[model samples]
Target chain A: MILEQTPDKSRKISWSYILLGISIVTIILFTLAPILWQVLTSVKTNEDISAIPNVYLPHKITLQHYLELFERRPFWLYIFNSALVSIVSTILCLLLGSPAAYALARMKLRGETIILVLIAVVTLFPYALLFLGVLEIIKNLGLGNNYLALIIPYTAINMPLTILVMRSFFRQLPQDLEDAAKIDGYKTISMLTAIILPMTLPALVTTGILTFIFAWNEYIFALTFITEETMKTVPVATAQLGGASLFDIPYGAIAAATILGTIPLVILVLIFQRRIVQGLTAGAVKG
Target chain B: MNNQRTGWILLFPALLLLFLIFLYPITRAFGLSLFTENLGTQLQPVFSGLANYQRMLGDGRFWQSMSNTAIFTIVSVALELVLGLSIALVLNQSFFGRGIVRTIAIIPWALPTSIMGLAWAWIFNDRFGVANDILQRLGLIETGINWLGEPGLAMVAIIIADVWKTTPFISIILLAGLQSISRDLYEAHKIDGAKPWQSFSQITLPLLMPQIMISLLFRFAQAFGIFDLVQVMTGGGPAGSTETVSIYIYSTVMRYLDFGYGAALVVATFMILITTVALVAWLFNRTKWA
Candidate 1:
């Protein structure tokens, strides 16, 4: 016998299997449809896209539109700006977020709850509602129409989650490790840099990836802050590019830009996906 | 205790950033809310006491936007949670090609909101859209639906778009929750001859409560603060049927240049969010503490 379970066990497995199968199929279709559509349309000409009977597959494939995005728009500049902003923002968020998270996690402060509440408050509200005031402050500080405005606010908004994540990761770590470092004569800063950080690589990577994605995909802040064309991030540039006019909305160019912009992130997600998923789902499943 | 100093020192940069960028703006916005004039004016915000609150109380648009927000948050968050949990439970099991499916599932969640908004807008287009094509092909409807053009259906369309984009997010989180549960618990349950539904109710749901709370909080926050999707999809149309509080505030600050009133609106949004977070945190604490 193949270790057949009792009727009840078999029935449970069957029901779960059925439900799982249905969900898998639903999720696969839902996730793939838009992506497939984006890829398919990227290769098709405008005429092919608007045809009465839609061409799901192109009879003739051409990379002309993707090629032309660079020819027409300052596509590469947007990519550079995005890269600079994302890299700088991610580094800053980690640098800033980790310490705050560590403090909130480890310290017994007088009003830690208040600080947590403060972080929560900032995260919950939309930046668009608060943009004008932020713009005012940015201008006053001589950071107007520059990348600093976006980077500062992006880091600020991301602080709470990053802090919470890093704090939780620090908290979950066995204290003995830190104690061991200390007993071995490692100073606090040295201990953190050498032992604690090295051990907390997974959490660090997770927070970094998530933060980069947020900064990379952020639109409203970049739109409101960086009005100068040269200062615009990828999403802002792509939106502006897409919204020029419905007639001139180069679907192929937009798709190409989207692909180019997101390809690195896609690869990053693929690489660290398990950790990212674990970190994200941490509060959801177990809490 | 020396370590505490290092912790504080380490935290100083973030604290400074928060104080300047987060605290100052919020405080200034709150202070501006108290004034009757724009912050841009030479005259600083003149103290108007509770007049801003008084004005907001009677403002029909404010109430209307709040109602719309309530509807949007409640309906969409609920649907996303249930669907997400169901899908998460399924995906949590051992299955062939599970890794590929899981990776692909995050595509919707990983998508830029603006792009998703644009894609969804095209999907819901009255004519030459994929959604209607599929629906018609399935014989679900005799005529094509004007998804974005109609009033009631516009909200539905926006919600559908939100659900499509965010349900995967909720699943990713909940699936994490499910993955954390020990398989031995299920083995024990099976040994006890518990049915699948029984195991789910007794084991999975209870174990997944924290994840559910987190998912609910994040989903509610996003939906309540939703702006870009509405901006791109309908531009708070057709006829302001989908005008959210964020949209209203954006117009006040950007379009009308009513910084005082816009600041007041921001204050109100902040209060609502704080209340929601506090309430949820309190509930979670109570459950855990008890």
Candidate 2:
């Protein structure tokens, strides 16, 4: 060692412990407050929500807003449209992405880094860039306010990252398994199904979850493509909560819808926290 | 031979889809930028050879949007980086309930931005909003402040909402960076008479630079084109103060039916982003951080 004098190392450790405790409390409270406020707002009566000096808690927790959300707007359609588009896009992304990824992984394509960078760059584009051309195509095809309008673009927008994530996973798999499967008389397609598919469950789940969340929360395309009241996705519908008629901006109902719209994602994040955490850090998915 | 064929076959469908949806549209937008047709006068396209871009250089709204985009990007991403690194460092310590803490952190990032923007809008709402209420109660102000009804405050509100929504993402990325740095380095540094702060600056910072740069790039791009938050929270607002380039272009094309000009704006924004990314990448490579 070069030297030994460091100021009060033991005391520093104790001080660090104190700092850690304070940080934990602060982080928890800071992260939880806005959400908790919204949740409280969800349960509050409308009058309580709008009350001067703001109601900190629900005077009476009610499901009326939840029910009224469905009654007053086409909230159910939003959920259905969101689910259908996200699920289909995620599946399509996987099916189309995985095979290409497998090829990149196994065949060891030239310009692999270039391809990955290109994909990354694609994902980085202003999502609004996809709006105009896609909108024109949708209108030209007369897919007016239709699910296909959202699906085509969502699937396309999500594909690059999906491929990158899947490619990384596929590349990490051992090659001897594929060799063994080939020796056992399995063709490339069969080997992919029988050997590779089962091995990539974690990657598939992460990609699917991330992709679904992206599509599910996608706002711009949904807002632009689907203008009809009946065709709105969850985000569009949620934004339109107060826009139904200018006179009727239901605060509690908006909160209830937000909470409702967010529940599935919250649950997904809880279940797949580890995979999501890993995928995010690897730069495999878009921010 | 068979394997190569299979590989190409597998890639064909995805490449075709990408060509149709992503690449093709971008090319169309680029080509559309050189036109003279006002979408309001006629839907027909006429090639005018860079006229739209020429006009963009002189447009005040274009400059406003460019700066607005820059301010939003610089301020929000800078805050996210600092806050993210702090939280990441905190989380890196072995602590009680770390898993729960991490999950709690992910919740905001996981939720939809527009919905959360709505919540924030309510929070900042002047009449019955929590922000004014809390400020009044604490004697921070004597009267209600119209948080989003003013230009500067509106931008600040957007930035605040953006930082709250996105800091977790940067924190998570940097956390992964912090975790990957070997504990043994710090241990060795301790023996060498290096204080904790010294070890952090000399070791953790340089080592974390790659992740930090990458995360910054990602956050920069995202914030540069932010639409949902501003659209929902302030809608480019109190007097076009928060009008990001994305918001501006969205209205120019969608609301005002200026497709040619809008296309020019998109292409211009793309060039700016590309140049910024290139410069950053060059810097990183020069510094060997990439």
Candidate 3:
């Protein structure tokens, strides 16, 4: 209504609407097209993808590329390794990170802020940098070519963020809840297990989901540490699509592998969509 | 009746695991940095002082990686922030299909980096890639450019891949921030005869600073430490143009069997990341308390 008095307001309104429209269209196309292209190419025969000025949609959909995917590599083994590592690491991180987070949140330590900051700092230390030291420790312990090597580091790197998230959620709980639980004669661990843990389910699920995804997608450490074919995780095996010796970089196969790799992650996101969004935003904004 | 002590006691298991598995290796990395070990013998870790740091300082390759990392982080993060904020604002509106669009938009971010690299690598293929195909069909180019093969274009390609996978991440965070802002504030601004731009600049942006900072922190850290995508896409190849610090460290320790030197590089990287993140945390805390 304020703009009604100003003639230029209509011009600006139209311009802004146009801008927003263009922006939306551009982002949708830029993001979705490449992904859709991957899917389309995956279903296309070799000749279709190789043809000049590729068709937007394949004339006939085929599962030949996907079939070739299984034929060319031990994808099942790689997926099994990925699942094993992701699940184990998620469990480990939650087990460690949750308690540490609770302690930091409730322990009344003199330098809780410093401890939290320390955890935050650790999140920035990527596995790439730490892989060297981790390798030596893993080798020294004779745990190479094992899932423990990947799971341990994944848990370690993810601990800080998990702790930060858990700590924040724990901080918001009323102290009286714990005091009342104690009044009811619940033991310390029992109180945590029965009362606090249930209250903090959302935080736990958030941390678990993020941890699982990170571990599931982890690559460099797995690549460097596990050379055995059976030990290779999804990311490592999928990355081999781009390796030098591969046959002309098999576009269809790579697309199929990419789709396969995205499936579990997409499923995780869909199932935990609400919790993930809630936890991610709340953790960041409040912290 | 002392619940706090018991809480700390309960924390011991987790703390011990962290100290043994996480803390030890980091400090060990620092210690390893001081040593030099030759591969041919049962070499003792002899102290080499700051020679490794000095070597990295003067190494052209390290500097190149550093520059590449800096460019990739700063530029892509800037774009992501801008795009993410706009998208978040749009999604914050009462529009149809918002949920569907938001969910679908997040697919790129949810997908793994290595997988994304594989997907984009196919898209960038000089021969059969969709990118070149689209460009040629649209008459944008006469011939397909070898996007990932060239030195200059390689960085751009990597940035494209990174942005595709991360803009949604930034948007999701910003959207969270956007949701926290009350409708009353915008209503108040409207009463004051504020334009949309004015409202955004004066109200939305200031309130969103914390979220923006966190987004920057997460994105910058991820970008700086990028390894899987570059490794999968480029492998620091075509004369090591796309090699990141992670790849460099990987090659040094695993490929060349120089554990001590590799450890030194890692320690250096850890120190830098910790220092930078600490500084940001401090700044945020100061602003918050002040």
Which candidate comes out best when scored by lDDT? 2
Q: Each candidate's TM vs. the true structure?
A: 0.90, 0.95, 0.92
**Tens digit per residue, CA lDDT, model 2, B1-290:** 77778888998888787766777767888988888657555867888898898898899988987898899899999999999999999988888799989988888898999989998888888887888999999999988999999999999988988999999998888898888899999999999999879999999999998888888888888898899999998889878899999999899888888888888888888888889998997988987933
Stretch of 10 with least lDDT, candidate 2 chain B? B36-45
Task: Return the clash pairs for model 3, or none.
Answer: none
**How much is B233 displaced in model 2, in angstroms?**
0.9
Task: State the DockQ, from 0 to 1, for candidate 3.
Answer: 0.60
By lDDT, rank the candidates, best first: 2, 3, 1
Off by over 4 Å in 1: A1-19, A104-121, A242-248, A282-287, B1-3, B38-47, B141-143, B283-290
Once fitted onto the true fold, the runs of candidate 3 whose alpha carbons sit more than 4 angstroms away are A1-22, A242-247, B1-4, B40-44, B282-290
> In candidate 1, what are the lDDT values of residues B8-100, reduced to their tens digit?
787788888777766777788888898776545544566787788899999998888888888888999999998888778778778999898
User: Whose TM-score is higher: candidate 1's or candidate 2's?
Assistant: 2
For candidate 2, what is the DockQ-based docking class?
medium
lDDT value for model 1:
0.78
The CA lDDT at A273 in model 3 is 78
What are the per-model C-alpha RMSD values against the true structure?
Answer: 3.3, 2.7, 2.7
List of chain A TM-scores, every candidate: 0.87, 0.90, 0.90
